[model samples]
Target: MKPRGTFRNTALALGLAFLYLPILSMMVFSFNNSRLVTVWDGPNSPTLKWYAKLFENSQILDAALLSVKIAAMTATGAVVLGTLAGLVLVRFGPFRGRAMLSAMTTAPLVMPEVITGLSLLLLFVALEQLTGWPEGRGVLTITIAHITFAMAYVTVVVQSRLAGFDDSLEEAALDLGAKPAKVFFAITLPLIAPALVSGWLLAFTLSWDDVVISQFVAGPSATTLPMVVFSKARLGVSPDINALATIMVLVVATGVVLSSVWMRRQERKRRLEEQMARSDAG
Candidate 1:
């Protein structure tokens, strides 16, 4: 038993090390003095020259801005549509073809990204020929494609939240003569706000990190940060790319930590309120 436990602990430590080693290396090399990403300078010889260069690159800056805009729009669109779909799935029962509809809604989540990208490309081409709308491919087209994929993830996250939610509160609201719409806006929406926020963040992160779909859907004028990074990496890794990647890592880590803290506080407050209500009723 002791040997088995030691082996398990060793395996877990090795797994964690393997997972984090690349990220650790990237962070370390972001301050490397060499322009080449692979070559390491002596300890204490680190430099921030690459970071400065990244800031000065206008093309990279523009692509970063474009990525942010697309992520924001995709997150908004995804949350709105996904929330509606989730409500329907949870509230409406025994509808014909409901299973099929649910499967289709989440199919993109498991589908190969290349297949999704190709399918969307074909869709855009057909839409252009039939309706002549969207006239030319650009940010709008990329955003639409991103929203389509992001909504699937958002839907799954929100649907899980809705499934675990109790309907007693809604019934109580209706029994008090509150209209369905009013109750939904005042009660349901507030109750599910955290799930909605989580779904939005998930969608935004998915869109921001996507490269395969974006590569196929984005037009000349809609180049994104990932695209720029990919193009640069083709010529071999540069310290500037490392700096950009490090920045992204820090930003994402910060957001995740803050969100976790906020959610924990909200959960604690809810529990305290519930306890107080029970005490009063007793």
Candidate 2:
């Protein structure tokens, strides 16, 4: 049993090491002063020059900013659309074409990204030819494509939450002369806020990291960070790539830390409020 336990621990360590070693290496290499990525001169090799160079790279910064803008827009649109779809599915009960709606909403989760990208490309081309609405493909096209896929994941998140939601809260609001919209706004929306937030974050992450869909829908005018990174990677990994990745790692880590702290504070505040209410009741 001890030997088995040791073996399990060793396996877990190896698994984690394998997953993180590349990231660790990237972080270390990002600080290297030398332009060549593979060279390890000595202990004093680490420097902040790459980070400085990264900031000076206007094209990479432009691409990163474009990606962020697209992600933000896509996440917001996905949340709104997803919430409406989820509310319809969960609250409205069995309706005509309910099965079809549900199927379509979940299909993106399983569909290959390449296939989805191709279909969206065809769709945008058709729309452009037929109406000339978009005229050309760029940020708007990329955003719409992202929203199309991200909305599916967001819908699933919200729909699952709504499915498990207690009907009593909304019913009570309605029983006390609240209209459907009022009840949704005052009661249901607040209750499902966490799901909405999760959905938005999920959508944003998907949009931010997407390569294939963006590649298909993106015009020459709107190059995304991932595309820039992929293009650079083809010529062999550069120190700038390492620096950019290290910065992203820092940003993600900071976000996680801040979010965890905020959640803990919120939890504490709720508990304190509960205690005060209990004291007043007594």
Best by lDDT: 2
The reply for model 2, stretches above 4 Å from the true place, is 1-9, 268-282
- Residue 202 alpha-carbon offset, candidate 2, angstroms: 1.0
When summed lDDT is taken over every stretch of 10 residues in candidate 1, the lowest stretch is 36-45
Report backbone clashes per prediction: 0, 0
Q: Per-residue lDDT for 1-282 in model 1, tens only?
A: 356988999999999999989998999999999766788887655888889999999999999999999999999999999998888888899699889879988999999999999999888888999999777788998999999999999899889988988999899999999999999998899999989998998999888888999988888888999999999899898888888999999998998899799889999999999999999957
- For candidate 2, what's the RMSD? 2.2
lDDT of 2 by residue, 1-282 (tens): 356988999999999999999899989988887778889756667788788889999999999999999999999999999999899989898999999999998889899999999999999999899999786999999999999999999999999999999999999999999999999999999999999999999999999999999999898999999999998999998898899999999999899899999999999999999999999956
Which ranges in model 1 have alpha carbons more than 4 Å from their true place?
1-9, 266-281
- In order, the Cα lDDT scores of the candidates are 0.90, 0.93
- For model 2, state the Cα shift of residue 78 in Å: 0.3
How does candidate 2 fare on TM-score? 0.92
